[model samples]
Target: MEVFALVGPLYRRVQRKIELDTARQGLSVGLRAVLDLLREHGPMTVPQMGRAQSISRQFVQRMVNDGAANGLVEAVPNPAHARSSLIRLTDAGRAAIEAAVAREHALLREAAGDLTTADVDTCVRVLGRMLRLFEDVDVNGQAVS
Candidate 1:
């Protein structure tokens, strides 16, 4: 119970760090995910990207639209869709994500400097379990993980 009590605040603090890092990089978390997904998987439709990232398709669509407007991504004709489009990272988008990832990694290493590799791995595993639990209960509950 005491550990549970500490978890919320600690999670929020970590979330805040991510929010701050995203803001400092001038990218929202959603946009960053889109860019990262594109960088890793080549090109994909917004729906495909959303599925890969576990974000809502509508939300992913909006991010792609925003990125398109900002010159980070462009709409390419998707023959399979005929209406919607596929998104691919521009050179600028790839560069932006690379920079943001480098900074985020540096921040994470600095913040977790006291922890051993095993400790970090354990933390990640715990968080993954928690997320899966939340997902399993999402339909019966009202919360975001």
Candidate 2:
């Protein structure tokens, strides 16, 4: 229970840091997440992104729309889905996200100065198990599984 309590505060602190860091580059938290997803997985549908993030499809759609307007992302025709297009990152998006991530990585490295790889690994394992314990629930507190 204490670990769960710590997780929420730590997450909020990191989220705040991310908002500050990304805002300088004219990106919101959602936009950064969209770019990161495209960078890691290449082109994907909006529905797929929503599923991966466990967020609303409408929310992801709004983020994609914003990214498209800013020329960070463009939608290409999907061969499998006639209705849904696959979203991919533009060169500008790639550059922006990469730079942001690199900056964040530097901050994380500084924060990790005292923590060992094994310590981090064990922490990750614990956190992952905790996440799985609630994986069946939707973001809205509805049962998903």
Candidate 3:
């Protein structure tokens, strides 16, 4: 219960900061997430992205549509799925992502003024364990592992 209490507030605070920081770069937090996903995982269909991000396919499609309008991303032919095109970041998109990442890194550095690398590593390990525990529990209240 204490963990749940901390997690919600922590997530909101972090998300708010990211939204503000990314907005300054002319991108919303969601779009920035999509950009990061594409950069990390390569071209993917809207449904694939939706699954990865735990969002709806329509929502991901909307983001991709907006990105296409801004020339930040382009739809390429998907060999496996004829109707669903794979989205890839454009040169402009990569530049925008880079700028946003730099801004985020600066913010993170300022926020982590006193925390050492070991502290961060410990936090990462703890969080990873918590995430795995959550993943092992099914939505219907069944323990999968």
Candidate 4:
């Protein structure tokens, strides 16, 4: 329970840090997520991204729209789906994400001084388990009980 209580605050703090970092590169958090996903997983539909991030399809669509408007991403034909075009990174998008990731990595490496591999591994294991515990929750957030 103590760990659970700490999770929310920790998440908020980390998210705020990321938001500040992304802003320097002229990216909103949603756009940064969309770009990161496309870069990591290749082209995908908005629904796929929504599912991947456990967010709403409509929200992902909005982010994709913004990316398209900025020439960061473009819609290409999806052979499997007649409609829902795949969103892909433009050359500029690739460059932007790479630079952003490089900057983040540089900052992340600075945090390694005080933590051991085992400590980080334990945190990952605990967080992963906690997340999976919510997998059975309904969309309305009701527990199975």
Candidate 1 lDDT tens digits, 70-132:
789988899788887788999889898889888878877777767898997997898788767
lDDT of 2 at 98: 98
User: Could you say which candidate leads in lDDT?
Assistant: 2
Q: Pick the candidate with the highest TM-score.
A: 2
Q: Give candidate 4 misplaced runs (Cα > 4 Å).
A: 138-145
Q: What is the TM-score of each candidate against the true structure?
A: 0.73, 0.95, 0.87, 0.87
Error of 1 at 34 (Å): 2.1
**Over the full model, what C-alpha lDDT does candidate 1 score relative to the true structure?**
0.81
Worst 10 residues of 3 by lDDT: 136-145
lDDT of 2 by residue, 52-124 (tens): 9988899999999999999999999999999999999999999999999999999989888789989999999
- lDDT agreement with native, every candidate: 0.81, 0.95, 0.87, 0.90
Cα lDDT tens digits, model 4, 1-145, are 8888998897798788889999987899999999999999999999999988878999999999999999999999999999889999999999988888888789879978999999999999998998798887755576645
Q: List pairs with backbone clashes in candidate 1.
A: none
> C-alpha displacement of 142 in model 2, angstroms?
0.6
- Model 2 misplaced regions, further than 4 Å: none
**C-alpha RMSD values across all candidates:** 3.6, 1.1, 2.8, 2.4
